[model samples]
Target: MEPWPFDTITPEEIDALTDEEKQGLDAAVAAYIGECLRRRGVDPAPPTSTPA
Candidate 1:
């Protein structure tokens, strides 16, 4: 897989989220990035996602 371009995330998404939802989304994003780094040289994380 490739690195995600977080720097290019759209302003539309910023506007779409409520303040509380945005806080949770930000936490989820940080977790995802940490997960990506941890898997960088090892087997990929399984795709059985914990859904919203």
Candidate 2:
């Protein structure tokens, strides 16, 4: 799956996502980046984010 460009995202686009949709999107993004790092033999700590 192709990742969406961060710069292309807007608040309206994010607001349109349902809570479930948001969670799924977040998980997919994490998986994609994690796999990329794994393929390169790099293991990093999981991410931490503050609540908005």
The clash numbers for all candidates, in the given order, read 0, 0
Question: What does candidate 2's lDDT look like per residue over 28-51, in tens digits?
Answer: 888999999999999967778733
lDDT of 2 at 11: 67
lDDT per model vs. reference: 0.72, 0.82
Name the runs in model 1 displaced over 4 angstroms: 1-9, 41-52
**What would you estimate as the lDDT of candidate 1?**
0.72
Candidate 1 least-lDDT 10 residues: 43-52
In TM-score terms, candidate 2 sits at: 0.70
Clashing pairs in 2: none
